[model samples]
Target: MRKTFLHIKIIFCSLVVFSSLAQSASFDCSKASSDVEKKICNTPSLSKLDEQLSEVFKPLKKQRTFQVLESEWLENVRNTCESVECLEDAYNEQIGFLSPLPLPGASASNEVKILPADKIYAQSSRPWKTVELAGLPNGKDVVERFLISAEVISGILHVVAFEGHYDVPNSIYRGSLYEYIDRHPIVQPITYTIAKDIGFQGAFNLGNNEEGERYAGIMGGTFYYREKIARNQLRGMAYKVGSGTQPQETSLLLQQWSNTFENAKSGLLFQGDEVFGELKAYYPNTPGYETIAPVDRPEVGWNIFSPIWSKSRPVLYFKNGDETIWRANVVDKTLTKIVSASDQLVIKNPTPVDLNGREAVVYLEDYILKIAVAPE
Candidate 1:
């Protein structure tokens, strides 16, 4: 796993500064000159300390465990006391009877594998086949579906992969199913917990009818089971895996090229001036679409093609008339167009498409070149 301690530490420091100075005189901790003095000044609030510890210790709680040995131990035991013969039969004939024997081999202990000190049990399953896309700019490629097993460790669900496969060049690529599981969130479970009752406990009933036995629940209710709950949660923990839910007008289009990509929603690339002087609307489903500015920027030099969720940045697909060039974001979201000769460049009239949920903007540096415009 990539060490994110430095990043976390930086965030921690920033929060400390914001809380101390940005609020009021009562919240100020600027009086302390040294780190030791600051610690002394902040030590009075044990409750605050407890809350902070709880916040940080949640992931640790999932990691800690206790062991128990299985044993056949019962507090109380009882058996039928005595047997009596019928009064009438005893009087008539000599009463004769044989004793019954007690059953044996029922004193064994049950064994179970306990969870390790640093994990919680969760299950995930995916499709059986890999969906391949042919003629994907560079070449034809295959992407596979996957199931993952994950556990919360250090406040993050680290995906300890055991299986998966991908169709690469000539051979199949398989192994280490969730290589980046440590970074992504367990969105659905966390969201469900927040939206619904976190402490609520319940069960499932299949039903008593014969038809119900075949299905989970039909006309009647059957067996009961408890729902699983997870702790150590984060805010805004929603799942977003595809681009279909988002509007198409934004420069960032969700490209599902690799399973490793973090926020698969904003890596789309079109023309440099794709949204040049056009009216666009933000997609409601997008997290920060409302904050997008309609104002334009320089199209030349460096332009951010997509949002940077993490280290993995967007790749650029640039075309000046019939000439086309492709380059990956080497430094964050900043794009530097590379110059090249136009050869087997494919240019067709862009079917007047609607920007469903997102708006577009044309940068100042890029000249508004028409789709039919050719270089002299």
Candidate 2:
């Protein structure tokens, strides 16, 4: 009963906050008539944010993208967000997008936020195939609709290919767990190579509060997918919502993949809601494995979405082969084949990096792409 009441109260408050349409960076609280206006007047955070946005809007108006966003865009977000938390999130996202890149020769901060190469959002891609699976195997076929796309988090780009299926629908059908698990759409990894010098510049704390911190350059090596290996070299910044400028950094702590190659006794994961997906999340638990795991896959390269962003439990890259790469747990060291492999493709000179959290990127076959793995 209490949970029900709390949910109701939350909705009420959300309604109370969106009852108005007039907004500005700085507004007269006394004259505030709408729920949004009143809340902004009462909330110090909102007021300060309004002031900041007011100042940012001036310079941002000159940009091409910002003009398209317009007042309706901002109003729609503010009005649609029912809770203060959601509202704040909407504001921050808007500001991030509206914030322009730094000018040439602009100064940057001395401190740098160094993430493992994997955490850095590098350019990535994956082979995509369409399939329709029964929500409950042999039960009913309703075209379980879903979409997969690359997303940027904390200023990093990530794309992960993963097997999709309905979770165990109920306990009565637990007897046929394996058969019910559909591993149809196999998610592959995006791979790329870094053969030369690499660099990471820090974010510039532009001398003024109005502009805020401009995203520093996120330097990624050559990015490509299977066929366009030579012509697909890609690098530079990938933003979640804003423009990222180059940062000032002396050096990047590199985790170089071994020129030497080795094979793992088994694949990284098996496809099942219970075990397979869970195991891939926390891979590379061993210390110093980051430098060693790159060469340990099925063949010449690694599969996509095998590596995570942490030092512990990183899945090495593998070359694609005629074998259907199976999923396995690191503890028991057992492997399960979701689908049979064809003699078409093989893994090759695989390279990988952590794209922050559980997502990682692998470069192979002269192309680059993203993969899903354990979260950070």
Candidate 3:
């Protein structure tokens, strides 16, 4: 009887140990075949970190850019971990990258207020207004779509529109490039014949060169292809327009081939060989280029994209994350958060405009174009 009781107690203890290991990790410990997977199952602290990382990665899995980053991390960082300590460190780093950081110096007094789409034009004390463009010349009704880019040059508004349905599969973003003079339309189709299946992926920029000649530029390809190209790769072209001259095409080399707005001294800003490399500037009229921001020291957040130039100053605005707009003064090396949405909103294409002598910003919110006037 004593022997039988000892046998029963040993079996019960073994079962408890098995159950703990099975339920600890985010993945099933029973099917854990890899060395790293086995280490995570056996270690309690590492298993907890794995669970935390899984939760943080859930919402961002659908993003293609994030997906690529995650895959690289798994192959380069997580899978190469040889010990439990290395695995723990890798998991922590990934979780931090996926999570949102606290907004720097966020306060109510300095935050820019955004009006509702329906009540944009309504009388209010808030400095918000919706962009009202006249009907297209082709008699087509102007629908509320995604504003890819917008700029005000010489008191004229140039805008590029997309289909606004980013979630849909294989939805081609073919729309007209319009020029609005004082809210009236002189719309023309800037036809994108190259890669018609994929459409444009980046912002449509309109700026002037050193000789005061105006030009228009945009990236033509899929997002993935553009993102993976090297610095020396030929990305797109810029067409020299206006000034009573014929449209002359100039090949734009490297990535981010758009011209930076600096009045009569506009130039090209692009990255180096590295994906997150040093920011370099090249003037069309100058002999050589200069470095604006080095790789070791980034002036602004690396994730900021869709640059909209300020006509009055040597400043450029970018959209950070999904809801914050950051203004970067390249000359002064200062980055300021100009706008922060109160809720979960995708604020896109922050364009600067002079509204009757009032400095204001125009951007897309839920497929509608809205403007926010700068505080005096």
What TM-score would each prediction reach against the true structure? 0.19, 0.24, 0.37
Best model number under TM-score: 3
Cα distance off (Å), candidate 2, residue 256: 35
Clashing pairs in 3: none
lDDT of each: 0.22, 0.32, 0.49
Top lDDT hit: 3
TM-score of 2: 0.24
Quote the lDDT for 21 in model 2.
25
Residue 4 Cα positional deviation in candidate 1, in Å, after optimal superposition: 60
Provide the lowest-lDDT 10-residue window in model 3: 205-214
What local lDDT does model 2 show for residue 352? 31
lDDT of 3 by residue, 1-376 (tens): 9999999999999999888788899888988999999999999999999899888777656433245456778888999999998998899878876664432232221122222223211111232323333332332433324444455444344444443223224332333333223321223333221222223334332211111222223223211112112333324433222222222224443243342443313343644221454434444444555544344443443443555566555556655555766655544445556676546766765767654344567666644445554443
Which structure is stronger by TM-score: 1 or 3? 3
Clashes of 3: 0
